[model samples]
Target chain A: MRAPGGVGRRWAPVLAVLAVLQCFTLLLLGLGQSAHAGDRPRGCGQPLPVAGSAGFANAQAARRTNVNTYGAAAIVEQATASQAYSGDLASRFRSGEGHFRLTFNDTFGAARLLTLCDDRDPGDQQTVMGVDDRDRWLKKDRLYEQPLDLYATNVYVSGGAQAIGGFYSASVTQSVLGYRGAMVAGQVINLYPAFFAPAVGNWQRGDGVASYAVDWVAGGYLDLGAVAARVGTAGANGLFVTVDERAIGLFGTLSRGVGEAQADPLAYLRAGLQGFSLRRFGAPRLSEAIGQSSLFFRDMPVGVDPSGDAELSRLRTLHLDQRAIAQQVEAALSYRVGQQSGLYDVHLGWHTPGFYGERSDLKGSVEAEDEGFGIRVGMIDVAPRYSLGVQGGRYFSARAQLRGEAITGMILFNDPEQLALFPFATNALSLRLVVDLAAGG
Target chain B: MSRSPHRPQRPARPGRLSSRSLSWLTLAAGLGCTQEVAPDRFCQEAATAIAGRTEACTGDLDLADARYAAFYEAYTCVDVPVESMGEDTASPIAPQDRLHCAFAIRNLPCSLVEAYGDDIEQYMTASPICDTLVQPKGGAR
Candidate 1:
């Protein structure tokens, strides 16, 4: 006789893989190449229409919205800094080495900087930080000769369209760790200056407003700052200034209709390349450098769960303290195929490690939404390990869109001992009910 | 007190081209290979190239139209002579460099600008070759 629920447990992974493959097939079938070669609006000799003041204003507004929405996603400061700390920790400590490990993590608020207006009310600025501190000591020598390890990850994100003057967004992450005389520190700051906004105009698209703008980005990262501030008898403070004056970002948004149609955007895309000038002048102990290049694009139908897609994208890119300092590029495309009283939504995404590593993954999910009730199931493959998760929720009313969602997942194809070591990966469940009563329903 | 056995090793510095040197190289190239083209010829070539390339890539005539209009307005390409433009500005872009900027915009790969048609405009403004077309007063070559 088989063990109770053994068959169901074994079949879950197979079912998840099948569902993802089916979505991929559908996506490929739906892909269509646009053809409009013979269409030319005006002759080369004829002068083009001049954009009026109102046109310029509308374009600026569109630019501001796009910047506030997709700016933070362009910054990889937190991911880069966190990876530095994890790299240092992994190199020093090993699991099951008879070492006592104590860990503490506390997050004040959800870090929803990528899509600022999706979570909260539009124009509401939110600041959040998460701290994870870990300490390890030798268990055998309890009295003396205890090798102490202390490290902390701090992330700070703030900015919105409602910010003073023009729109502003900033993200900073600092990682510091000390093991005896050896100390390492890494900090990344992404700043969008108020004056960075450039003149933009909307391109007349018949029924929608489409605008694109490029902003000059100026920010620097301090990699391995004070790496060995106090090493042995010789102590020398080190500072790494990595400035990228030539950094530039491109943001674009397309929205259908006019006034009310402008409330929801149809497509959003942003791409940025930051080339840093690394200069080492003063006498310093040790330093490690950091650089980033990212491309983000999201196309989703209106009236669907935007926050859900954002959260899903965030979870896909959330590397924790495991991934190395490799370049990362992620893109998500969601489509609503059918709608009756309910809707069928399929999201397809692909993420690849940029510049540094050779690990890439494809993720897909299918969701059914009907009468304010929704359920989604998805899977993400991270090479040797993969996790399958199911999320279900419902909306109560229009003004008060109360949603109670519960997500549960487990690492199906991974080492049992590894799962035991990382308890969070083994059959984890989280439930949250959010109620928003903000103005303007 | 016994010292920890594993002292963290200093990470090796990554081998990457310095941005400062890259900027200098770009400036040197611009100065050494400055080309001179008539204003009318420059405008005609730029308009023809941008219109063909942008239309082929995006299939959106409105976007192509807007880009052409923006480019004309930026360089005063519509019935404006090269002598009158950038007269008061110091270190004006050499006539050949201006044409180079136009060609660069025209030659932008479809793969780079296909995702968003409007991005072509951004590339025109941000690209080192194209940005020199509208240089600020006393700007570097």
Candidate 2:
């Protein structure tokens, strides 16, 4: 079933008719070409052996050098209100993060496979040379002096081999400052990879893929790297370390042709399950608060001990000391015809307590000067997300996706009063648009 | 070898050949037909080879001899300029240098960077690759 570019899934029946018509048209075109050739099609006799052909060589060179530029602009609207400089409650808004990515892919070794199921054919081994740069600037509300900037570049070589029963693929990358997925200024999204430390802050990762057919493709991956956890001065003031800032994830997908191939608009129904566990251990460090440090504060308030006598004077920094594991399971029904694609899916996710909490400990009895300075390790819940993704275009590609998460947990609200005022976490609406500069129509 | 009695010998036409001569001629023709990779194909292969080496995992410095082969091949084919990093140079002739240089910058080991940095720097600074990014149509170096 194929529908108009960017059309929603509600028009599945129309798309099915269009897809059948398109296929018929393609069949007629193929028949005409064969009739004109006065012979059956056989890849025109292997492209006349490309070696020594200047035009062929030039085409190959062009493909190798082709650079695809991608521009993405996203705006996130959250339910929370901002209380920045003034105590006045201000409607908080997260506006723009403009990202530019340059991607170059070199294909060689074997002819490209048409589908993941092509692995069963054992004739379409391919090697891919990929490199990309992702750079972005995030604007946040009154938290830091400078806008948060992220720059990541990676070069990876991936090769896929079609073997008996299936195809196997593997790749190793040397990356410098690489971060993947949706990353917000103060938000950490679950279910992704982080690199191992000591490789370079840029981090390196390896991924493997196996596909027996379109219906059965599986992947497992791991990334290791220490992420810098900053404690704001209004809260705890210290630079702490994450002992286990690593992530490991596994995902599997199964898709099978559904309905009558010729009459039913539903072509394939697919489902995927993925789970990830991320753990970070932060070590406590000794630090001082205002009016407590004898060297820093010359005029101590009454009952304030410059000699560390006051219980509130000693503030030691401790992190949430958390191990978070989150799981996502989703099933999507897609309608595709021509070059247009539409997908509607039901997404379910489970998040453990401490998965989203960032807290620090106050070692002394005076209680940490910051009101929010402890961890809540007892909350967990499952939430459902409804999302729609549409993609259209032949050469230059455009993809728009919208996902809404029904809030089931108020993890961001710390104070009981605040929780009472805002019984649920703000509903999050994420919208993103990506434009590919080097697409062909 | 003796000719078969049942085979009647035909008169050779002018410029025609005996069996032995025909065999030699065919052999010569086949030898001359040895396939040579086209220039564009060579460049692509060179880039892929270079990328392969660049992506290979090396600890400290994988100084393995094979690793540099692709880099050297790319350097040779892409015509890396002898000019210094900031020196003005002509637009790069080999477009693959853009891809290869990106690999070097993003994935190359620090040890190899020390060895190859000068060349990579020179090429990237004068690279037409960057210029093509803004062009309505780009990719050709």
For lDDT, the strongest prediction is 1
Which residue runs does candidate 2 get wrong by more than 4 Å?
A1-211, A214-441, B1-38, B52-141
lDDT by residue for model 2 (B1-141), tens: 111112333455688455345434422221111111222333333333222223232211123233333344334443232111221326433222333333333333445534554253232332334223221112333
Off by over 4 Å in 1: A1-70, A76-86, A89-441, B1-24, B27-37, B45-80, B85-141
Docking class of 1: incorrect
DockQ, candidate no. 2: 0.02
How do the residues A1-441 of candidate 2 rate in per-residue lDDT, one tens digit apiece? Answer: 434552344234333533443453344333322222211121121111212111222222222111100000000000000001111111110011111111111111111100101011113222311221111001000010000111111111111221101111111111111011122211111001111111222122212111000001112111121211111100010111111111221111111222333321111111121112222123222111000100010111111111121121111111111122221111112121111122211112223222222223211100111111112222212111000000111111111122111011121211211111111111111111111110110
Question: If you score just chain A, what TM-score does every candidate get?
Answer: 0.18, 0.17
Judge candidate 2 at residue A426 and give its lDDT: 14
Taking all chains together, the TM-score of candidate 2 against the true structure is: 0.18
DockQ of each: 0.01, 0.02
Model 1 residue A196 CA deviation in Å: 16
Q: Quote the lDDT for A203 in model 1.
A: 15
Check candidate 1 and list the clashing pairs. Answer: A327-A354, B35-B96
On DockQ, the leading prediction is 2
Candidate 2's C-alpha lDDT?
0.19
lDDT of 1 by residue, B3-35 (tens): 232233333336833433432342222111111
